[model samples]
Target: MPIWGWPMTEILFFFEVVLAGLLAGTMYSLVALGFVLIYKASATFNFAQGAMVFFAVLSFVGFMELGLPFVLAFLVTILLMIAVGYATERLVIEPLTGQSEDTMLMATIGLAFVLQGLAQAVWGVEVRRLDLGIPDFPIPWLADNLGIFVSALDVTAGVVAGVLIIVLSLLFRFTKMGLGLRAVADDPGAAASIGIPLKNIMLLVWSTAGIVALVTGMMWGARAGVQFALVDLALKALPVLIIGGFSSIPGAIVGGLIIGVVEKTLEVYVGPYFGGGIEGWAPYVLAILFLLWRPEGLFGEKIIRRV
Candidate 1:
């Protein structure tokens, strides 16, 4: 039998895992970013964001299947996402108007189911391949007896995610609209008093979240194909968000990376020793511990609510 020590193959696997984690973190960041954005603006969890990602990915791929070129298909999909966002804000969120935050959260939960059903009905519940136009070449550089390898797709995912993160940072820094978004997120009441249109701002926040969803869909769909994976992914993102603090963008990204790394490592080394795999519960375990030790997370603002 081979020695139990960490072999070259194992070392290579770890590298790939780290690379994959970075990419996965980006997608998770997008999901967590949705929470931050909506919570910053409306103080609601906006749980439907995951379903939004699922629908956006499925819709984009579906349009592509209908013979539209990549750019056209994406444009159409983005428009639909914008409409979905506006409709959610107008119909569900607006009608509840002034209700307790729990009420709005419940509304989003309902909206999540509605979106899920729509995705299944429209996409036939089958996994559809998404053409993200990334070159799917194998990384043969790590060859020989070691034969350490990673897919081009994983690299592309990391690059795309990095690009999106940089773009978001720039947008929030340079653009007038982004400035408005930050102001609203920081203080919606003050923003309104200063002439930022609340309605347009809300629409813009949701649409931006949706666009982030599109990038998420493209990257993940490129991996597992587009389907109900969005739901599963949303569940995965919860712990990341919990540990990262719900409002900080960098926290979300960092939380995703931590979850990805810890879960993968635990599954590899500690999982089989106990039973089969422990990846499923790793994040929750870490989240709970973090909560106990530091309830505010690594980057969360400590808001002291006096009794």
Candidate 2:
């Protein structure tokens, strides 16, 4: 098939695929950030991050349905996330104080299962319309008298994502609280000895991760409507973690972009020949390929252990 023969709409569809891949990467950054934060603080990889994102989004949507204004609803949801974070540390993490990294990781997996059940129980196993005041109608563009359109939703998603990355970078770079967080991540034992309040910093990271998850959920919910469907997006983030390295912020964002673009492009261009499952597994395939070449990931820190 000649590329020049395609309809204008088809070309616009290609643009949308690229935008979605980039946006998916941004979303993956947020999810992978949650994993990295928890991992950095306690050396435990939290497998429940996807569930956490879905759960936070559900909370935001559910709270808005109770008639609260968006600002108020968002604040309440953040506070709720803080409480959840504290509980996660005190209850789930605290009891396993002296466990190995593998043990803690397994515990987080259990937490993931528990969170999945909690989402079903709280949301009643049904999909809900979760609009958060974002309108998504697109305007049309013309080329050769053919229409190519860009969606208001896609524009908003991208802008929201860019703004979020900038804001997070600022938060982690300029604030006193942010400095405390870095100290904690770099060396908790040293941080504790120096009055950095190590446990408090861990709680803050979890709460911050929760807040990021809330935004992710709202953005995603706007596109697909909130439901248990969020778990699918969360699952897509795992391969992102592998490619980005377990502890790198830049890694998360870049890995996500790579996965998103490759997966979307393949699904559009090559999926028909492979029974149409490209969208579901292509990211994993890409991650495995990345892993084989650089086991530490592109941005992962290289730690030297002495015997």
| Whole-model lDDT per candidate | 0.79, 0.78
Q: Write down the lDDT that model 2 would get.
A: 0.78
- Residue pairs with backbone atoms closer than 3 Å in model 1 (clashes): none
The residue pairs that clash in candidate 2, if any, are: none
lDDT of 1 by residue, 1-307 (tens): 2246878666777776676666666667767776777776676788888898898999898888889999999999999999999998899877886787788888999999998899889877888877666756566674444465556777776667667777776777798987888787667778889899888978988898899888887878887788897778777788888888877677888898888878877776778899956877788989999899888777878856667
Q: What's the lDDT of the predicted structure labeled candidate 1?
A: 0.79
Supply the TM-score for candidate 1. 0.89
- Which regions of candidate 1 are displaced past 4 Å? 1-13, 133-137, 142-147
By how many angstroms RMSD does model 2 differ from the true structure? 3.0
lDDT tens string, model 2, 9-31? 68777887787677667766767
Q: After superposition, how far is residue 57 of candidate 2 from its true place, in Å?
A: 1.5
How many clashes show up per model?
0, 0
Alpha carbon deviation, residue 185, candidate 2 (Å): 2.1
lDDT at position 262, candidate 1: 80
